[model samples]
Target: MRRLLILFAAAVAAPVLAADPAPEIRRAPVPPQALGVAHTLRTIPEACARLQGEFSGDAAAPYRFAVVRTSPGCRPRARLVDAAQARPSPASGWILNDLIRVPSAACATQQAVVRVWRQPAQVAPPALDPQGRARVYLEDSLQQARAGRLAPLPAYAVSLQVEGLPCPR
Candidate 1:
């Protein structure tokens, strides 16, 4: 009876275990808007400032920013930015790209700056939602606004190594 029960249990679990997991469903892209233009600035900080001003730095709903950096301490460049609160979980936070690892052995440098005339589509801005779901209208609007010529403006930012600052290598 025990051997029969074991066989039965194995048979039941075999189908369940062999079944594939459901694929994650992401939102589809929206259609393009008319050929338009968005005024451009020259740095990620400028982009952050623009959003902050628009949001009026509201305490309850403050504009969030993800500061991206590049290094080697030898070469510096504006990598990418995501407008969302940096969360611990992958599904609910600033999804980071590859880090600009600067080896101290070859490059022992200081002070860096990164800027860009416009944010690219591939590295588009993040339309954050506290609930961590698809933000259709917000993402769509940003996408539309950025899909055009950008008139460059003079705006930039700087970074440095500060003593006593907690950093994760």
Candidate 2:
């Protein structure tokens, strides 16, 4: 009987003890935009050749525009081009909450930027539908703007990171 009671108590406390604390969200002021163009010519085909334009100091859009070589060889071919906006997640380490893509271009890769707003997760009562399912939260800034909510502007510390695939050929 004592063992059974101890097992029950442990089961009751386990979830509470294992619960993860809310993540710390950091925010930083946006950096001033600088205008300039820097060209990098790579000697090897393996190295990426970069043409960077404008500087905002933000990770998402470090430059207003940037053109990079898609592959080591200068071959014209179709390639998959994708960009994702991500945030740190305790369970998964990072979660890609938003994504965008650009159509395949020529040998010279076209540049893209994925801007994200980093803010503390808001705790609110779930909005349940008639069937009792929780409403889906909108993560897209454009959708939020269409709904009349002003999306937070991107800042230096708001976004965790912006990942992109090699330029499409």
Best by lDDT: 2
Off-target runs (Cα >4 Å) in candidate 1 are: 1-85, 106-169
Q: Candidate 1 — what's its lDDT?
A: 0.29
Q: Please list all clashing residue pairs in model 1, or write none if there are none.
A: none
TM-score of each: 0.17, 0.19
Clashing residue pairs for model 2: none
Query: What tens-digit string does per-residue lDDT give for candidate 1 at 1-169?
Result: 5466445645654574354233222223222211122211122432343211111122332212223332224232332323222221235322322111111211122101111122223344456689976566766667767996333333222221111111123
Among all candidates shown, the one with the greatest TM-score: 2
Instruction: Give the clash count for each candidate.
Output: 0, 0
- Worst lDDT run of 10 residues, candidate 1, spans 106-115
